[model samples]
Each structure stands twice: as structure tokens, then as C-alpha cells.
Target: MTQAENERRGNVPPSNKRYFYRTYGLTIASQLELPELPKAEATSQPDVVVLTPGVAEKLEGATFRKGWLEMGDDRCQITIEGVARYRVEDGQRILLDRRVPREVDPVADPGDIRLFLLGSALGGLLHQRHWLPLHVSALKTPSGVWAFTGHSGAGKSTIGAWLHYTQNWPLVTDDVAVIKPHEDIPYLHPGPPRVKLWKDALAALGIQTEGLVRDLTREDKYHLMLNKGFQDHPSPLKALVMLERAEEGEAASLERIRGVEAFKSVMATLYRPEMGTEFNTAEQLMRESIKLAGKIRVYRFRRPWSLDQMNSSIEPLLHEIKQ
Candidate 1:
């Protein structure tokens, strides 16, 4: 029967058993089985609950309305054209509305939905819960968790993939670094045990992408799931390494950032800084940023852009972390 007919006859039933998963230090019970996240033990009370697909209601009294997004005091609605509409409320609940006409099979067709679920929706929820999410890929070392933050194509994931695959360092998270603020030291929560690597990166790392899952948005990028070497718990954040492209043929250097420059650099790494402004006060963000800057050491690492220098580029960071 057609999907439309199934819907019309009320034959598309939601899953009877909710799936429990964990990421970024939160337990989630989701109607959809998200294989991208690590499975968690069943819990009666989860930190977040993801409901089944349903009609999305208009956010009442939305204070911020822009292209494809609406935000209120405690709720956010994100409409991705031709994909799905998501509602994240009070940092606890998430509701999905499928925009595509395909059959409702969460397991088989969860790539696109899971992408946004872990991206914009989760980012919004984190902001609401007062956690700082930075755009970084992290790996756990003997000292502590080291996070790499930089612009796109700055080799964050490539470096991370190299270390995880070659050096046996456990990957903490990829793409988004979740920070739980504290007085003495902030903590970094582990995210999904996957790294999205471009084709060239995979080749550079001597990895075969035959069975790897392709990224939904990037045609040339594939998701590499680390089943073995993955940090699955929260760890005290050690340092922030900011990667920058150095002049061709110039030697790589690592230097410490201090005072105002450190604070500004940390602020620049915020994964959705606008969400912080919308869901939280400027004073709140400032306070957290200041706390993070004061507590953590931020290092600026400049390296040549060539792939040949990838190993040499990581040397400076590895040496610095050992100190």
C-alpha cells in the first residue's frame, strides 16, 4: 500500500518501545532508534525524550523569526525544506514532523532526521540548558581532553581522525564540543563516536570507505564510526587548540593565547553563538566565556595547509599536551 493510503487508514503506528541512547552526557529516550548515538541502559526517567512524528504546532509568541527557524523563550521550531520540521521545547522534549512523503521507518530512514537532530535541534537544546557548545573535535589524552577548534577545512576532523586511527588516542567528540561550566574547571562531554571525513582525508589516513556511511549533506564526506577507540564519559577539559593556516612552506608553531585575546578566541569557537544570544542573556554568555577563558588554557596552532605536513603539524600539539 502507498504511504498516503497507510496514513489515511491510520495504519502507520508509532513504535511501541522507546529506544534509549546517550550523548553529550544526557540520557535520551527516543521513539526513533538512532544508531548514530551510543545505546544507554533503559531508564524510567530520561534527561530528554524524543516523541514520535506528529503535526508541528506554530510556536506561540515567538520572539525570533528568521529563515527556516522560529524561537520563543523556551521552544524552538526548525523547518528544513524537504527534510523535516523539528520542535525542541524547554531543553527536554523534541517532536519531529516528517516533510518527506516516504514511509515512516525510523531505523531505515534516519540519516537525514538524525543529522538535524544532532545538529541544530540538539544545539538549541544545549543552549537552553546553559551549556556551551563549541565547534571542535576532541580527543582524550593521558593529561586530559584536548579539543581542536577552527574554521571549516582547517583539518580539525582530519587531525582527529589521524590521531584516533593511527596514534590510538580515544576520540571524545567530533564537530561539537559540549562544555559543562563549573567554578574551578569546566568539563567536556563525549558526543557520538563518529567522525565525518572528506574523501581526501580518508585517503590520507589510509582508510577504505567502502562500507562507510556517506554524509547526507556532503557528497564527498563519509562518517567514520569508531567502535573501539572512543571516550564515552565526561572528562575535565585540558586545553583548546585553535588551528590556523600558515603561509605555504612556513614552519608550524604553537603559542599560548592569554587575556583578552584568549577570551575573544574562545568566544569565536561557539558552535551556534546566535542561539546563546536568543536563549540566554548577554551577561550569562559573557560570564561563562570569562569563566572558561580564565580556567582553561587556549593555544593557537599555526600549520601549513598541505596534507604532507599533517603528521608534523600534530607533533607540536602532542608535545604541548605532554607538558
Candidate 2:
């Protein structure tokens, strides 16, 4: 798009001071550059544009959904009620508006709200754009990328952080892994290099939190930016591991899942999956899931929630992957 066109679309105050960023296989141009993301070389035509709040006129019947998100055919709005509101349109533009209360601490950083948008709000945008976003954290192995996925508090990020810190593996992405099937092989795109972990996970990994920053939404969780051993490029997806908590008598074990069971597990990890229904991506994702199940090995990884059990399970998991 051109400068005049951007202004007409409610992308405000177009200036030459554009910050370009690449993540999840798309280029973004914005005025306020995110410190957490690596900068991309300047691009003339960006895939997504970010602007200050201007385009959002109240949609008459928009009601808040389960995750404080509302969506229509071509647009979505995220409202943090008293904190901020964001609208993404046509999967191409995002506009943010903040609503801080008078009682908030004066020293509180406003950037935290933007970071929140970058998480769930950005995932909504990717879903609208028809990208398959998985609730996964991945590591780079000599074979390829191995993705660990499960429900919240299933230790995906914790395991990813542990592997990166102790095993010297590169973290490909944290929280969301945007994937695409190319030439019969699924590829995992790189996201932000930082891994978010709870305080308990940090303690288990022997990480000091003296200088760490807490997650904006979850105070107990913190962010750890991987300065070294961070992968910025997409890699072929080699394996999928579905993390599950071990039952009382169960020991930590990795077992293969096949056919329909593998497909169901992969489907469960998709980010903001409800939005995929509105965008008609369910069938597409289903096809991709089946193809992935057929081509790659999938495993059910069970472990007790203790740090010692988690540590012990790693070697066996690695051995299974080697086979």
C-alpha cells in the first residue's frame, strides 16, 4: 500500500520512521518497535501494519466472548475492559487504544499492555490470516524441530527453557508456533526468542529471577530472553510430543501415538481455535494435521509434575526421538 492509502485506512501519521519486523512468516511495519522482537530489514510493502487507535468505531452488537475477544467476518476486537482495547482488521492492520485507570501506579509501564496484545491479540490476527498457530514451544535438534504441546500449565515452556539452558539446544519459539506444510514436510516458523516461565519452573531450572521481568498478565510467570542459541529461521518439523501429567502410579514414559489419536492431539494445540471456525480454517488445519500425522512421528509424553521426574524423563525422550 501507499502512504496516502495507509492514511485513508486509518493508519495514522505516516512517517519515514517505520520499524520493520518479521515473525511467524509475515513482515510487520509499525511506528512503535517492539523491544522483544528482532528487527527486519526495511520492506516497502509489509504484510501487516500497526497504527495508533483510529479506525475503531463501535460495532453495534459486538459482545465480549470467552477470552475478551470479539470477531466478525474480516475483523476482530480485543478488549481488556479497563486496561486497553485493540482491533485487527482484514488480518492486515492492528490499532491499539489504552484505558488506564486513575488508580494504577504512576511508575507502571504502559508497554506491558502492548506486550499483552502481542501475545493473544497477535494470535488472533494470525488465525484470521489463516496461519496454523499451535500452543507449542519448540527446540532445534540435529534432526529438526521438536514441538512440545499441551494444555496450559503442562510444562511446555518449562521443558523448552530447560532444554535450551542445560542441553544447549536452540529455542525455536515460545507459546505459539506458526506452522505450514510445505512439500509434504511441515515447517515451524520462528517466533519471539524469549521463553515465559512461572516462578516454580524457574526454580526447578535453577534460574535466578533477580533481573527477570514478570509476564504482564500473569505476575507469577516471568520472561527469559534467550540471547544465545535462538533460531530465527524456519526448520522442518521432525516430531510432535503431547505432554500429559502422569497419574499416581504412572511413571514418566514416552509412547507413540498414531492415526486418529495423533490427529486429535494436534488439533487440540491450535491457538484460539474457535476463531478458526469463523475463518473456515478448521478443514484446512484438519488436513494439515492428518498429513503431519502420516509423515512424522507423534508421541504422548507423560511425567510427574516434579522437577526430578521431569529431569529424568528427558534422556528417555531423547532416546525415543533418536529411534
Candidate 3:
């Protein structure tokens, strides 16, 4: 019988295994094991639950549609053409619907499902919960947690990896940096323990890509889990450094930004900013951004982008952080 038929007839056998994971300050109870996230003790009532694959359901009265995503107030439906369909509801549950048959696709190779689950689905859930998710890589230092943010290919991951591998800073999070809303100080929550790097970035760090899990969407990129330098707890926000590529032969520079520009910079780093609009969360996000701008320091760091100058470019930022 086909997968859909089995679901229709209620013939799908329930798996006995259960997994618990912690990420973005939330405890998750899932039917599938997520190797990217650090394991947590099982909880009777987790903050989120990821259900096993079953029948797909249509979302009613979706207010926004963009590409493969449909978003409403408390629910989101994401359809990846050939892979799977995911529904995130009320900031608490995730329902998976695999497009491919089970016989054709084994459970062992769940990279595609994991990719969207951790990326788009989780982002939507964060929106539902009213947390600020920034597109940045972050690390915890003695002072506090510092984050790097910029446009894609702007060296956020590269700098973050360099600092972790060479400087021995514990990695707090990668890709999506979750900030809990607060009245006084902004706190960053730890995310999945893995970092995604391109082949060239790995080579620049003198690390081999063998045995690394390839990113399902990008063949040249791979996910590397930090076994030793992973921080799994929330930390107070320190500073946010915005990276910009400098002209050839130009020296690296770091300058502190304040007031309106700082607020705009933080707003620009939002993960899936359109979700704020669709969920009618723009005003709250703006208020939080303003609070974040007032509480933390923001800096613009301009440096050369070549791999050869990676160390020289990063040193000044480290020195500035120490000051």
C-alpha cells in the first residue's frame, strides 16, 4: 500500500523511539532524532513537539503567500516541491508530510527534512512565539555573547568559524541567532551545535570535508558540528558587529554606530523579516529593536574579504571587543 493510503487507512505503525532536543531556548520532543541539536533530558511537556509524518492538511485563511511558504497568524505551511510538506502551528507543534514514499527513501537519510525543519519551519515558529531571530553567527566570550551579522556571503560564518577554531571562543549559535524579548537587557539563546561552511571556507581553515554532512540544498556546503566548543545556554548580549568588504589595499576598520543607524542595522539582520509583516508583528519587533539598540553596542567592521587576509582582518575586531 502507498504511504498516503496507509495514512488514510490508519495502517502506519507508530515508531517506538522518541527523541528530545534543546535549541533556541526551547525544549523539543520529536519522533525523529535531530543530530544537529544537542540532546536534552526527556520532558513530559516539551515547549515544542514534532509529530511523525501523517496526512497533509490544508491551512485555512492563510494571509500571506510567498514562493513555497504560506503564513497566517499562528500557523505556517511550507512545501518543498520534491521533498516534503511541513506545517508549523501555534508555536508549539510541527507536522511532517513526506512527499516521497518510505520504501524509496530510508529514515537514515533525513537531511532534506532536517534542513527545512531547522530553517524555515523553526523560523516560522519563532515568529509565532514573538522572539527575535537574527541572521547572524554568535559566540560567547568572557564579557558576554557577541554576534556577527551582514548580508549573505559577507563573512559572518567565516569570521565565526575562525574565532571558534583559532581563538577558542565557544560558539553560541550559527545562522539564526535568537534573542529573547526583554525590558532591560537582550539575551541570546543557544541554537543547534552545527555550523555550515562552504568547501572553500573549510579549506581556508585547513579542515577536510570528509565525513561531513553535505547541505541538501547546496552541494558545495557542509555542516560541521563542534564537539568541544559548543555553548548550550543563554547569554547576555554584548555587541553586534556588521561586516562589510573593504576595497583592495584598504586597511581594516571598526567603528561604533549609535542611535537610528544602529536600530536600522539590527532590524536589517532579522531572519525572514516579512514574517513580521504577515503576522502583524512589525510594531512589537520595532519596539524590541529599539530596546536592543539602546542596550547593546553596534559596530560596522570593514575589512578585506580574501582568505589570505582573514587573520589580519579578524585581529582588529577581537582587539576592539577586548576594549
TM-score of each: 0.91, 0.88, 0.91
- Candidate 3 segments exceeding 4 Å error: 1-11, 55-58, 100-108
Q: Estimate, for each residue in 108-217, the C-alpha lDDT of model 2 and write its tens digit.
A: 25456556667777887887777778889899976778999999889899888888787788899887878765545588887777889999888988889898888767
Alpha-carbon RMSD of each model: 3.0, 4.9, 3.2
Q: How many residue pairs clash in each candidate?
A: 0, 0, 0
lDDT by candidate, in order shown: 0.82, 0.76, 0.82
Task: Output the lDDT of residue 290, model 3.
Answer: 89
In model 2, the runs with Cα more than 4 Å from the true position are 1-16, 55-57, 60-67, 99-108, 181-184
Clashes of 2: 0
Tens digits of per-residue lDDT, candidate 3, 208-285, equal 999998987789989887867888888888899999999989999999999999999999998988876665467888
Error of 3 at 143 (Å): 2.8
Flag clash pairs in model 3.
Answer: none
